[model samples]
Structures are given as C-alpha cells and as structure tokens.
Target: MKYQDLKAGIRSHLEDAAEDFFMVGYFLRQISENALFTEDGYKSIWEFAKGEYGLSTSSASRFMAINARFSIDGGEHMAEKYIGMGVSKLQEMLGLPDEELEKVTQETTVREIRAMKKRQEAPRSFYGFPKTERPEGSLLTTPGCGDGKYDCFSCCRECAIRQEPRHCRTAPLGNPFPCTRVNNEEWKKNIAYSLYKDECQLLHPELAPVREGDKEPDPCCLNCTNKTCFNRCDVAKKKDEDEKKQSQEELRKQQREAEAKRPEPSDRDIKAFYDWAGIKTTDNITAEDLKKRYKNAGGGGGRGAALQDYTGSARGIRINHKKELTWVQIAKRIKEIQEAEKKKADFVERSNGAQKNVRDLIKQQEEKRRIEAEEKKAARAAAKLQAEAEEPGKPEIIDGDFREVEDEPMDDPAQEAAKTRDERQEPEPVLCDTCEHEGECAGKKTHENGCMGYEEKAQELEAEAEPNPEEYARFDVESILKKEKGYLDGGREADCPAKFIKEHKILVDALTLLLEKMDAEGGAED
Candidate 1:
C-alpha cells in the first residue's frame, strides 16, 4: 500500500479506539518496545504520542510500563484480562503474585481493582513488623552460654530483641523453617571472624573467647588488672588531658582570629564621639552608655564592644554581646587619646588667659561707671553749696526754690571733713549770708542766740565732731567682694574649687586603673 493510504487507515482506527483501553495499552507497548514511532518518520515516542495518539505523556508512560510488566510474565491470558483495565489499575496489577493478580482480575471495574490493591499493599504500621505474636518452641529455649547464640532466633523468648522475628518461627505451623525466617548462619560466621580478629571485640564479647589447648584457658578476661603482665588484654586508650587542653587552646586561637577579622570603627567616628561626650578617654565609658550614644547618633545596633576595644584595652568591653574588633581601630584610638592628653596642659593655659581677658574688661567697665557717678555728685554739691553761699537778695524762685546768682562757690562741710583728718575743725562763718533779717542784726556775727549764720557755723562744728560709722562698713564690704571677684577670675584656684578638681582627677585615675586591672584579668581568662 502507498504510505499516505496506510497512514490514513491507521489514524482512522486510532480515532475509533480512542476510548478503548485495551487497544491503547497494546499500541503503547508496541511503540515503546520496538521504537516503532521513531522508525516511522517521528523524532521520538513522546512526539508520536503528542502527534499520532491523543494520550498525554504520563498516561502513555503508564500504559507502556503496565504492558511491559505483563509481557515479562509471558501470560497472554493474564494480559488480556487486565487490558480492559484503566492505566492506573493495570499498573497496580503488574508485579503482583499470581494469587493477588487473579484476585485483582476478578474485580469487574477499575475502582474495585484499585480498592483491592490498596488493601493488599497498605501496612498495619509504618514499620510493617508483626505485632502480638508469641515466640515458637525453638525460640522459647535459651542457647548455651557465650556459645555465639546472640541472634534473636537462637535467643530465649524473654530476650528484648525477640520483637517481630517471632512471626518467622510461629506463623507457618509444622514447618521446620518458615519462609519469613532468614538464615543468619552465614552472617554469624562472617561477624564471628571479624569479632575474633579484635575488630568488633567491644560490640561482641562472646567472639573473643579463650579456646582449648591454650596456656591460660579462660573464656574471658573482663576483670584482669595486672600492670606488668606480658599477655594483657589490648584496648582502645582514653584521650589525654594534655591533648584536651591543646584542643581548647586551638579553639580559642580560632575565635581570636575570627574576632580580629571584624570591621573597625573609623578614626573620624571615634574623635566625633569623644568630642560629643566631652571626655578624652573612651575607657572610662561603659559599653551600655556607649551603645546608647551610638544609637542616638544613628550608629545603629551592636554590642558597641568593638568601639570600646578600640581604646586598646586588654579585653573588649563586655556588653549585651561580646562584639568582635579589628586591630587597626585599637591602635588608632590609643594614639589619638595619647596625643590629646599631651596637648591638654597647653589647652588649659590658653583657656585661663581668655578668662583673665574677660575679667579685666568687666573691671574696667565698673570703674568707668563709678567715676561717672562721682563726677555727677560733685557737680550737684558745687551748685547747692554755691546757692547757700550767695549774698542776701530778693529771691528769684524757680520750682519753689531760691536761685543763686553766679558767684564764687562756698566750702562744703562734708568735702572738708574728707580732706582734713582733724574732726574738731570748724569753718569760719559769713555774717547774715542770704538771710532776710540781716538788717535787724545788731551783733549777729558774734551773737549765738539771734544770728542765722551763727547757728549754721555751730551745726558745721557739730558735723566735724561726729564720725559716720556706716561709711567705714561700706568700704570693708567692697574690699572683700573685690578679692572674691579676683579669685573667681583666676578660675577659683585659691578656694575649695581647686581642691575639688584635684580630687576628681584622682578619682578618674583610680577608675582608669581599676578598669585596666579588670581588662588584664579578663584577657588572662580568655
């Protein structure tokens, strides 16, 4: 026949038998076994299933596997009975024994065969071991002592290892050996040779027996503890304490190497932190406080121990976690702090000089203000004394007070008291000076009773005689305050403040020493 005519006939038959499982299996078996599709103008059998047949790849593969299993059994009648079965049912029927296969073939439908197969294959438990079966008479008797009867078959019924193997001896009645039972005689011989050779002596002591015709015919040497004996039992030696110590040391060294590889804090970051904290040494700062500042500065989370260790302490700061460090940062921060400390004395001296300048400026300003006030008081006193010293005249009043004509100024009693040391000195008086009743004076200059100038001269004499105690008190307070201002300007160097600074420095040094001691102890521990 022509190839086109033959192909058309085959395709029409395939379409008609599309739902027929028997024809599907038959064709799938022929295609797979002979590679018939690849021989007939197709690249592969999968492509042939896609193009020529309407079956999926998985369905085609199942049909092929089921057909191959039946062909191996060489049973045409058996294959015919299962050919009508679905691909899944036929696959389950394959490789089953004749009894199981016959039972599955009696199932008229695919669902019935699947259910029967599932029941047959499903185990009661995951382990598939027989439960609740008692040992047979052979297993009930115990074997001879140390005679290599460790196998569960030769063990007594009371043995713990006689679990599932009891089914082997008890299941098939009247048979000397049941099919379930494995012949362990060959396994025993092989394992016995290895144990007697001392390779498995720790596991099986029965194989290490002292046989007959030996000088010392003991079955076992479990309790022999002779030190100098020529023939002693050889055993595995326990590990030495020195070797354990070496291993621990090596582990610590590995940890140190790992810690050393961690990323370091930059010099810029360290200096910025020191400037913010207002302290020169990071060693004085606790790990937790540093972490707080670090987080506040957007430095993120960590133990902050690496930053601490960067101060070149013997031990890394122990915080919430023992953070790793790099050697470079440790060296960098140490150098930076040392240089800063060296320049600290110069910095303090400059600071003191600047304070002195500020104090001098304040003192000059106060002195200028005091001078200006004294000048104003002098001008007011000169004007008032000149008015009182004016000659008698018709009063030219302004703001209800007499105005004096321009004249030579009169002597002030208070100014005279300041100039002269003598308190009993009285000033010479002018007769009826600025008095309205001067025309009625008979002996007004000399008379004490009726003269107004006589009364003023007497008052000036009394003022010269008396001492003002309040003026001296004001002078003493001003002197004390000036001294205090000087001390403050010198940065409180003369007072208890200097002592406090010294004591605080001593405390800081003591704490630094304590921290160093702790670091040394921790490093020793590590």
Candidate 2:
C-alpha cells in the first residue's frame, strides 16, 4: 500500500476503535514502543509516522483485540511487520478483577496491584484463550472489595489523574514507584497526613543532612497524586539519600587516605590513652589489652591472625581451654580463670596500692595542673600590665609607612571571627617556610614553589587588610571566566538531574559493577 493510504487506514482504524477504549490504548502503546523512526528522540513511532512517512500508526479494528485476534492467512500474523508479541495477549491474560483494574486505572491506588499479579495463572473462568483451572491445592483467590464488576468507561488511564512514579513510597510487588490511589474513591488531593508525611517520598540521591525531625520540604505535602515524579524534581528525597551515601563513602575514603598520611599518634596522646586504660604505658599493655585499645580507637577486623588468635569479641566469651564448649560453659571457664588471675595479681598490686592510692594520685595530679594554670593566668595579667606601661615610650618596631595591614580601619569582631574560622579551614599550601627576601616572599628562586619567607608573607599580610583595587579586579575577572566555562547559562539537556540521574546512574553503575564481578562487562544484556 502507498504510505498515504497506509496512514489513512491506521488513522481510520484508531478513530473507529475509539468506541472500544481497550483497542485505542493497545494501538497507542504499540505505536509508542515500536513505531519511532529515529533511534534516539522524544518522538514516538506514531508521531514519526505522521511526520516522516506521512503514515499513521493508529488502529481501527472490528475486534477489540483484547485477548486474541485470528487472521485468515494461515501461520500469518497481522500484515504489519510484527515486533511485539505479548502485549495484547498479556493484557487479556491478566486475571485481575474488573473492580481492581478500574481502581488501579482511574483512582491511582496501587496497593491492590500488590496482591494481583501479571505473570501468575488466571482463575478458571476468566475470559481468555486456553483458560486453565486454578491449582487444586491453592488456598484461596478471594476477590478484593467490589472486585467483580468491570466498566469500559473508567478502564483507560486518561480518565484518571496523572501520577509520577516517584511520588509514592509504595510500589507494587515488582514495580517501582507506582501510584498509591484507591478504587472508586473520591479524588481528594490530601487524605490522612500520614499518606504524605510518612508514605509519599521523593526518589533522589541528594545528601540529606542530620536533623531532629522531618527536614524535607513541607510544601511537598499538599500537592501530590502520590505519583513518582523523581525525574522532574530537582531535590528528590532519594537523590538526597544517594548524595549522602556518596558523600559518606567519599568521606570514608578521604579519611582512609588522610589517616594513611597522618603522622603517628603523638607521645602525649598515646600515653594519656594508655593511662586511661589503667596501663602504666602502651608498651606495658598486653596483646589482648592492645586489641581492646584498638577497638576503642575505632578500628575493625583484618586477616593474617589465626582464627583463635584474637580475644573474644565484646559480645563473646573466652574459652580458657581448647574444647567444644557451649557459651555458658565458656563464660563459666572465663570467670574462673579471671578470678584466679585476679588473685595472683592482687598479691603484688596490693603492696603497691598502699604506697600510692590510684585515686589520690590522680587527684594530686589534677591539683597540680590547676595550680599551674593559675600561675600562667597571673603571669599573662602581669605581662599585659607591663606592655601597657611600656606602650607610650617605645619607638614601634612595626614600620607604619610600609604597612602590610590596612592603616584606614580597625577590625570588626564579626569579621575577625569569620577570618579566624576561614584561616582554620584552609589546607596548608606548599610554600617555602624560609626566605631571605626583604619585602615579601616574592619573585625568588627557591626549591619550595618559591613560597619561602612565610614570616615575611605574614608581615605583609598584617600590613594589607584591604587589597589593591586593580589587583582585586584582575583576580575577579579570571575567577568569573573559569566559572563560565564549567556550565551553560541554562542547564544541559543531557545532564539528567542528579536525583533522576542518580536513579539511572545507580542502576546502571550497579549493573556495570555486577557485570564486572561476573566477568561479563563486555557481554550482551540478558
């Protein structure tokens, strides 16, 4: 047939099929799935047909094609090249009650879909080809509330509200992010607050910060079909979850790297920790005590030790002897061994205990620290008074004319606090700590990034509270140019939102990771 004639037939078929709603949807979905012209584009096959070939992909048929359609040509399918096989059959084969389908189709409640299934066997009397009986030993196939009646009007999805998949927390047995509406129910936007507050959640991967209560947007509460709308929303809850997980993983990795780089514990902290454990020094502690200290220090398990080399975990009991002992038996043995050890150690410790009561010793140490702290405070006060007395007479060492700090203004408390915090946060950069230059750590040949003379740099910093106008302007221009390159004024089309993007990314990443582990990264999808 000519393309124009074919298009007419399809459009006519669709118009005629409107009387039968099932056929209309069947036509729409088939056209949607298989009819697009380009491999990648928003246009559907039906849309492509209308545009490119001047063809129409819609259908008008004498039969609803709800279950099965027989063709006159033997072993022949419908005239059009067939790509999809099960859709029509699957719909007809579905044994869901009319009431249930109606509820699912129009009301948007997906709870009923949970128990009902698409792949399972149909009831014996369901109207379809090659009907089979329910299993002989089956418990029951009781119909849900008002499940028997099926009306043609409310069967198609267009008659009802639109719900995005991410809007509802509950998805059906195998499906993700389906509607949570009910059957023949009044279409109230808000039901029980619980429906939204607890049940409806977004599906994004943004990091959610720790908060005392629900920190998600309250405005998200009222307007919902409870449809999953992760794709459209910028700040989906799932995206927050994903971001947090990613940030946590990054933090863990960064911490691992940092810990690897970190210098070993200082002598003071190590000694303090050992003392707190009631050990004289870390070197004096036993392997078991070391294990305890490691646990307290937030360490976990590793290999190379024998299975029994380690002490019993916090929740386990030690076995004094090599035997198959029950937990109770092990506990009893441990207690007995511990009591014996205590008795043996007591003899030596009791003599030492009299010489210096542990508590009294600690108290004496604390008192000495307090006295030292008071002395330091008094010395600081005396020095401040002397500095004030000498302030008037001395020729200032700080050269006022070559001021590194601004001469115009004194500091604001708020600004000073902010500056102090910023200073604390900045990672120390690679700079030469030593320089012989006079004015600043400037234009000099040195091994360390020419950043030597930090003391000179410090002096310059003290002088220059306000930057030179021309210098600041030049720096600002470069920063703005770099930012412009990173993004378009508007966002990119392909740059899927992090939330929906994360959903797809996580799924694809999981698939890739799984494939790699399975040694099937290059293999075809199953």
Give the number of the best model, judged by TM-score: 1
lDDT of 2 by residue, 1-526 (tens): 3334433545675566433333333443344435433443534444454464354332222122331232224122332322232334324324444443443442233344544544335432222222222456867442211232322111212222211222233235465443334221332334433343223322110111212242322223223345453322333445666867999999989866865664443323332332333442113333454445433233212343122122334433222212222234433443444444444455335434633574586578668766766776677679889989888675767755773765445378756655666779853333332454432343344423344455565675455333232332333334333433222221123232356444444544554454454344334332
> Count of backbone clashes for each model?
0, 36
TM-score to true structure, per model = 0.25, 0.20
1-526 per-residue lDDT for model 1 (tens digits)? 3434433544664677643443455565555446666657775555577677676655665555554566536322334555555555666655344555667654556667556646654222211222233347645443222222233332222222243332232234455332221233544455455423232322222223333442211222232332232222322011233556789999999988886665554544555445544665435544444444443233313454433322323333222223433334433564566466545544456556755876797688668756766776677689789988885778665677557878455499755654454455654333453343343454244444565555676775564343333333333434444543443444333223466456545545554554455466652311
- Residue 501 in candidate 1, Cα distance off native in Å: 26
Point out where model 1 deviates above 4 Å.
Answer: 1-65, 72-97, 100-273, 276-285, 296-343, 346-526
Backbone clashes in candidate 2 total 36
Q: At residue 355, give the lDDT of candidate 2.
A: 35
What is the C-alpha local distance difference test score of candidate 1? 0.46
- Cα deviation of 505 in candidate 1 (Å)? 29
Question: CA lDDT, every prediction?
Answer: 0.46, 0.38
Cα-lDDT of candidate 2: 0.38
Q: Provide C-alpha RMSD values for all models, in order.
A: 25.3, 42.6
The deviation in Å at residue 379 for candidate 2 is 59
